[model samples]
Target: MSFTLGLIINPFAGLGGSVALKGSDGADTVARALELGAQPRAQLRALTALEALKGLTFRLITWGGDMGELVAREAGFEPEVIGRQQGAVSTAGDTETAAMAMVEAGADLILFAGGDGTARNVCATLGTSCPVLGIPAGVKIHSGVYAITPGAAGEIAAMLIRGELVALDSGEVRDIDEEAFRAGQVRARYYGELLVPSEPRYVQHVKNGAREDEALVLDDIAADFEESMESGVRYIMGSGSTVAAIMDHLGIPNTLLGVDVIEDGELIASDCTARDLLTLTQGCAARIVITPIGGQGHLIGRGNQQLSPELLNRLGRSAFHVVATKTKLKLLAGRPLLIDSGDSAVDQALSGLVAVHTGYRDQVLYRIG
Candidate 1:
């Protein structure tokens, strides 16, 4: 039995990441991102997944233009374009209509590329009628429907099309207020759920917020990090409450959801952009201190896009110091921490066992991929 795969690519997805707009949800934000020289990667990301399905016996169904057909063609698949796109720039309506058309066409799975907004739009149309998967091509992807990486999405899709056993589960579709997000407030709300393919190694878990009980652990980890801080050395602090605790302990103002830079116990830069970090790291000995995303165990690339792959490569693996509460690690249930820095070379280079600071004077070796 040949499986039918529906593809939807949000061309504007992840356009605001390196430029540091927090998200690309609205038309104005997308425009601004382009003005800042943000290039579309959704097509390339979708192509990465489709490359794995090159020889698979599956019928490709998608929309016209950059939504899906273009990417499918580029990836060597002659996709049957069903829905018609509006103008040059696609809108949320296009995503919704394409998804609904895919369902109507009896697609076995709907593979989409975008952030939470795209997920929400597709979920609104398909609901639980079809299984869905995301290619992780966005700035902020708190939705559980996304694969760990684009390659992983392809691998999982291949398994499904090859008649391999894969469990289906309800994946959460979440969206946050973009306005509030730009102002440093994270106000994420659950939109709904979509039936998604579940493969432990391929699919990502939903991001978990900080728990109240982790306060003491954070304090301990902060104290440990503070003690290890060297004078005259720059520290690039990645975003998260865990990293925020380090700044709080030093009485330095920090961006709770943005990357910051510190030098010799002084705030050099707050809420630094990727360009800012790249500029700061030139000829300076800098070390990165980051905490994994709760539940998902992602050390980089989820929320902290400011720490781009170039920055990570410049710093090398030795300059990284991973910190997490015991509770966060426990939530992984033996799953290794993940890293999707948008650079496969960097991702592979950083993969392996790394030490994670759990608490004061405590550490554990965890795998990073």
Candidate 2:
């Protein structure tokens, strides 16, 4: 049986990432991101998923222009335009209207391209009625409705359309206060929930806060890391509590939700941007220390865009040091650690087995791909 799929692309979703504004939450931020040379990838990200569903028997429903129609066409699917925007750019209201139209059109599933804000808009509109999946095209995607990667999103959607997967579950719609986020504070709140396809291997889980037990493990890992720190060497610390523990141990400030830099156990930069990282690491021997997101097993490309693929390649795999608690690793259940650095070559180069520091002088080898 053929299914009807709803597609919505938020053209300005991830505009603020590479430029380091933290999030593209409002019109002003999107405009500023463009001014700072940030290009929209929502359409390109949408295409990655749609390309995977090329031969699937489904009717595409979408909005006109950069919202969805254009991307669906670029992906070789003739989508029915069900809604229209008033001006050259689309807004949150446009997203709401499109989602509502998709529901009225009897869409079996809605596939949207955006981050947390877009997810919240769709949730506000559809609630628990229609199933939804997210293409990871935004800067901050704390929601659980998104697939692990855009390609994974397409694969899961295609399987559902082909009647290969039938189970569905309520995925949390979470968003952070971008204003507070930019000011170095994390204020994540539950927005609502959306019905999502339940495929643990494909769909990503919501990020969880650090636990009390994890804190002790982090301290041990920090002690090990500090002991191994070499003088005059730069360390680019990726965002996470595990990495934060290192900074805490040193009595230096750290960006809990943003990347930072240190040299000889001193803060060099706080809340560094991608460009800042590139400039700081130039002509310097640098190593990147990161921890995977809880439950998702993602070491890069989910929230830490400051560590761009170019930077990863420049540092090489040998320069990477991963730290995670045994509890976090157990959550993976032996699944390979994932990396979606937005560079296929880098992802391939960084794949394979790597050691993860779990405690002082204790480590475990894990595969990343």
Candidate 3:
């Protein structure tokens, strides 16, 4: 039996993150950015993952542009707008109103864009009864509920709808202190449970670095990270063997499989909860350096939960630094990086070419869907 699929597009998810926009939750900052020529594609960008649903038949409940309904139509799905569109709400209250309408419509799963703020709203409206997915469209998305990319979300949903056996799993729904988030100082706290499918493989678990007796050139990688420490940038280390090497440079031990946060060359927290990581980076304008989980090619939320929805907003989507050896990127051989942002909706938001850093002097463009 298929489920009733609901859709809501913030349409402004990551716009503020790059241009120093504070929030995309219908905030005035988003409006100001739009007035000053901020493009709306970031909102639409989150909708691309739905392209996978090209032939699927499920009832769609959604809001219009700024909500991303037009894009949904383009993806071959016509959705009913449950609320009166006010052009677009420029504040969090508007988002809540939209969510409330979707809930009232008896939508089963609400796939949405933006970071943790969006997640928090889903929690408020649907709680555990309604499962929600984040499309990783905003700057700082830290919760474990977002899909690493949009297509990945679609892939998982496709499997679920096809009756594939994916175990249902429940993960943390988290948020960061907004004021602290803006300053790069963060204090993340958990709100509640996010719906997960039974045996659901649609979402991915957090990833970590590989360790061997000799992790092959591990010292060299650590040395490179040591140099980065000297660069004195606040580093948001993603999961994987490459990032594990950075921990070696910091002289601090790491879990090697979870997200880590460090400031001014020292470890601020390891395997931190999204809330704690956000509090730590609240006011610090440090860059987040992450590597795709080797086989997974995820740059955002797979193994890096600290990039919670709220934190990602503060850091902005542009703050992401995807790192890998050229050899490893070849491992994917041009396959779009898989996303399991914990939320299928967020996964959809990250569906496009993104800039990833492979070395201090190297950056490669890659698709993340």
The top-ranked prediction according to lDDT is 1
Pitting candidate 1 against candidate 3, the one with the higher TM-score is 1
lDDT of 1 by residue, 1-369 (tens): 579999999999998887778889889999998898777878888988898998889889999988998889888888898987888789999999999989899899999999898999999888888999999999899999999999999999999999999999999998889889888788989999999997889999888875666678888999999999998789999888888888899999988888889999999998877889999989999999998898898888887878888899998889999998878888999998888877788999999999999999999999986
* TM-scores vs. true structure, each candidate: 0.97, 0.94, 0.58
Question: Whole-model lDDT for model 1 versus the true structure?
Answer: 0.89
lDDT of 2 by residue, 193-260 (tens): 99999988888889775575567778899999999999988999988888888889989898888888
Determine which window of 10 residues in candidate 1 has minimal summed lDDT.
209-218
Evaluate residue 194 in candidate 2 and report its C-alpha lDDT on the 0 to 100 scale.
97
- What lDDT is reached at residue 18 by model 3? 31
Residue 233 error, candidate 3, Å: 17
Instruction: For model 3, state the Cα shift of residue 148 in Å.
Output: 1.4
> Which residue pairs in model 2 clash with each other?
none
Number of clashing pairs per prediction, in order: 0, 0, 67
